[model samples]
Target: MTAITNKGSGPIIQEIAAVIVENKAYLSEIDGKIGDGDHGVNMAKGFGRASDRISAEDTLTDAMQTLSDVLMAEIGGSMGPLYGMMFSDMADHLEDTDQIDAAVFGAMLRAGLEGVQEIGSASVGDKTLLDTFVPALEAYDSALAGGADFAAALDAMKAAAATGRDSTIDMVAKIGRSARLGERSRGVLDAGATSCCMILTGFADGIKTRLT
Candidate 1:
């Protein structure tokens, strides 16, 4: 029953932001193949802005709220609104929780996923972020149901996120700007899926290190 405290976990978001900022160029490069080529730039901008506002003593909920605000208001592209709503829903789910155990985290993840699904038209296998996000959540839940601890469930989620991201390589773009490319989009990985993998693995790693 490993859990991480809700208090003073804002730095985890900062670390996640750093990961996004550091990979900005690479993400954009991936997007250049099939999309507008601004995914990384927009992601880095929003996450970095949120990181600067988040303090070390702030709660995870507070940090995520800030991230959601920035992403929704400052970043451009469809992802901004999708990710913004996701984080907002996730933070709202954890607003009153003091400890983040497997069950609690799973609820938060589901909230975020639902937020994304509610506002977006894409579904699983659409070669979108849902490709990575849905599988990761399912894996996390399955691991916990199988009697794995919180940390192990997070590991399962991270692995599934990576596999989902990779699965996009062979998928034809079914939505977004890439959809227009049809068959031409099959060989390249979906940029949204890649970034979604980063975010999920970031959460898993951050929580794993804080588990007690």
Candidate 2:
């Protein structure tokens, strides 16, 4: 299959909101194990507000920007600003494009990663969202380098995201509130990583459905 259109796809963004909102309970549950247990609540509130403002006529970039704006402005957690920058950076990379191929997708991913890194000190194996996002991007690049189609590359990304999320279960928290737990944090999954997997997988699946 060819690449998906770069024109804003409102439904895709809506689907992302839906996925986050639907999984609110799960996200908060995980966070309760290592954090303030408000990850899902804040995420649902931010995404829900964005969904309400975004119309079907909005472009994918438009929808992402709206979400970023809300997350950055209204939410009050590390995730709020982190995810706000991520979506904002992703939208920045796609704003002028009309088509998104595998390479374009990779660039967008890299931009989002950089955006998050700019504001956060977490790194790979820190039991943070980077655990999921970094490997997912790497897997996507690897799949494309191996001549895989966009759809196949997305599949590889999703698989790698899940693996990365799971890997966090055994990782000691190296940042954030969970770091206080020290060795105790190793038994449960990182809420940020878990939510990142959901977001990445949801995004890939949503875009795949729009592929030509």
Candidate 3:
């Protein structure tokens, strides 16, 4: 089985943060279509702060914990709390592991999904982040169960995340502020789904690069 050492994986979190920060304007623009336009600004702020605090030698779990803390305590948007809990749960699941293999990663992904579901009432088709998150997790686990290697599973996950994110474009908002817009929300992509795809894809790419 291929695995990546947790000890030197902190830079992956930094790279994820960079991806968020780089796409700040784009994310907010998506949100501006039907909801508050601060999704990108808030996400970038929280991720940027966490990235600055994470060290090159820090473990992936440690870096994620820092990110969770920053998002939960400093950010003021709904996404902050949701993503904070998700990362917190994911880090907790991986806290004791030295090597991140397919099984371990699947458990971590499940934990994160559970965390998001616990605090939020939205379901898979609600046009929230779960649209992207749920399918990505399913694809990753499905790939692993089908005998794919870690890198291959990550590829499956990344593809699913993108597909799920795009799927949101045709979904009417069933929750959040956008729900008020009803049919008007159908033409635009959900901002949460977009960011979720970026995060999952970033994770997949990072893990694939570190797999050994």
Candidate 4:
């Protein structure tokens, strides 16, 4: 297997920051219904820090570790742990190898999702990031199983994650602060799920941009 060089840190942070910045208002709106209404602010603030740190970092794992440190130490609310574990786990998984192939990339995403599940205590269909992440991971694996290339696999995963994020709009909250709203949480999007999709999209876009 040709070891695919990892997407560098700068693009990683930039993509994540761009998505959070672009969706700031929308994320805040979703958080308003079920959370502290500051998901956007807190996320942007944290990713901003991560992006700035990327300039000083040499590897993708370093970027993830830096993001983990910032999120764990500085941010508040449920996101801190959830996203913190995500980057941390991704970094850990990717650190051993100089590059990652499609199968390895699938495992990397699954590790991050597992870490988030560990922290958030949420499962698939919980109307959280798990909703988006789980499907995306599955889609990535399935695409690989179906003999897709890296680019094609990533495309499939992106589509699946976007669908998963959209599915949250009609779902009642089953976990997190949103669960307290009972059925009222329905009809509104899940901010975490939306951000989840954005992350996956950003990741895919970054890789595509680099590979192209």
Clashes of each: 0, 3, 0, 0
Predicted candidate 4 versus true structure: per-residue lDDT over 1-212, tens digit per residue:
32356645445666777788878888898889877788888888888877777763356677778888889999967888899999899989988576677777788888898898787777777789888998888898988899888888889999999999999988888998889888888988899999889989988876766552
Q: What's the true lDDT of residue 179 in model 1?
A: 98
In candidate 2, what are the lDDT values of residues 56-143, reduced to their tens digit?
8778888889999999999969999999999999999998788888898899999999999999999898899999999999999999
Candidate numbers, best lDDT first, in rank order: 3, 1, 2, 4
Worst ten-residue run, lDDT, model 3?
A: 1-10
Instruction: Residues 38-104, candidate 1: write the lDDT tens digits.
Output: 9999999999999999999999999999999999988858988999999999999999689888899
Evaluated against the true structure, the overall lDDT of model 2 is 0.92
Which of 3 and 4 is ahead in lDDT?
3
- Model 3 TM-score, 2 decimals: 0.98
Tell me each candidate's TM-score: 0.98, 0.98, 0.98, 0.93
- Model 3 residue runs over 4 Å out of place are none
TM-score of 2: 0.98
Q: Give RMSD to native, each candidate.
A: 0.7, 0.9, 0.8, 1.9
